[model samples]
Target: MTGANGVPEGFVPLPTSAFVEHLGGLYHAPEAPEHTFGMRVGPEHANVRGRAHGGFLATAVDVATSRGARAAMGDGSGVSTVTMTMDYLAPVDVGEWIQLVTTVDRVGGRTVFATCRVTAGDRLVARGSVVLARIRPRA
Candidate 1:
């Protein structure tokens, strides 16, 4: 079960609350704890032309940004996505596990900035930046 890096291969890397639970639709990072999101590529999320859908890429970025903010703020941080911009660099094939890395650039009293990248086997498939606003919990 060792992966290429010597880590256990095929082992679900993320927590149960992360992506696998959602059937590759969503995922979260435990180290960040501030964010939770998931990504999908390959055939399950491809377009009719057989390329990864642009909308899915954007959603992944947005989810990562929001989850990262949540991780930073902790439970009940009341963060919400305000804006997201994504750039599709290359086409991705089905069955390839797309890797997503999200980083929180800044966390202010009212806003958060995050960046994420989607890659397939060392090739960049998409990249994005997202802005989120922190709000008060609903009554």
Candidate 2:
């Protein structure tokens, strides 16, 4: 029951930028209560110690929280991270598949707050909180 490239059966490619594309592959499972984002760590994502870099884990959290904010705000409402705080709980090694479970904490008139738990396989690796400014187009 695996999808393309062996991602979980429910996950599909998420909307992303060139920078995210460079991170290997990103997937999303919208059917989850709090949408899940996933990626398999690659050699380039590792630090000199051969562990997944903090920057890479930060990016994963950022993307998950940002997307969670946008989903909470509904379609046509874009979001930009205003503040992000991350707690590194454990180290993840290269080649491990990591998944981020994002939950929207609140959605206000012009901002959204979200949090995420990052896991590699069954081990919790990180947790993050993000505040996103909602961007709406002017008429």
Candidate 3:
């Protein structure tokens, strides 16, 4: 994180104007090891149990992994997620801040693999892996 509520270096915040903005304060930094992301838990992101919903966590993983893929592919190569898998290990409550650390595992001819781990401070909350297939260039 840079300053007050600022994202990490090379990371960008997903403003309220974007679709995933509903996730609330999502951010991602594509740099190695810095493939980092953060979001503060809010009321809307919680479930009846008052903890962050599974969907919310899953969505965050998707956003982080997908964007990290783009950074890995650079300017020209295109990719789209083919599958994603996540494991929930703990719950996150409102007012808590969670960060997603992701890495591009591999980029083959037609597939890319990414993995993410979500944590609240040092507590592991969730882990995810995503597979993205190359998108054919238009003629």
Scored by TM-score, the top model is: 2
Per-candidate RMSD, Å:
4.5, 1.5, 2.8
Give the 10-residue window scoring lowest on summed lDDT in candidate 3.
1-10
Question: After superposition, which runs of candidate 1 have C-alpha atoms over 4 Å from their true positions?
Answer: 1-23, 29-42
lDDT of 2 by residue, 20-120 (tens): 88887688987877779999888999999999999999999998888777776677789999999999999999878899999898888898888999999
Q: lDDT-based ranking, best first? A: 2, 3, 1
Better of 1 and 2 by lDDT: 2
Measured against the true structure, the TM-scores of the candidates, in listed sequence, are 0.73, 0.92, 0.83
Candidate ranking (TM-score, best to worst): 2, 3, 1
**lDDT by residue for model 1 (70-96), tens:** 766674776778888888999887666
lDDT of 2: 0.87
Which stretches of model 3 miss by more than 4 angstroms?
A: 1-17, 29-32, 136-139
Per-residue C-alpha lDDT of model 3 across residues 42-85, encoded as one tens digit per residue: 89989999999999999888888876777667757677779999
**lDDT measured at residue 63 in model 3 versus the true structure, 0 to 100:** 81
Off by over 4 Å in 2: 1-4
Candidate 1 or 3, higher lDDT? 3
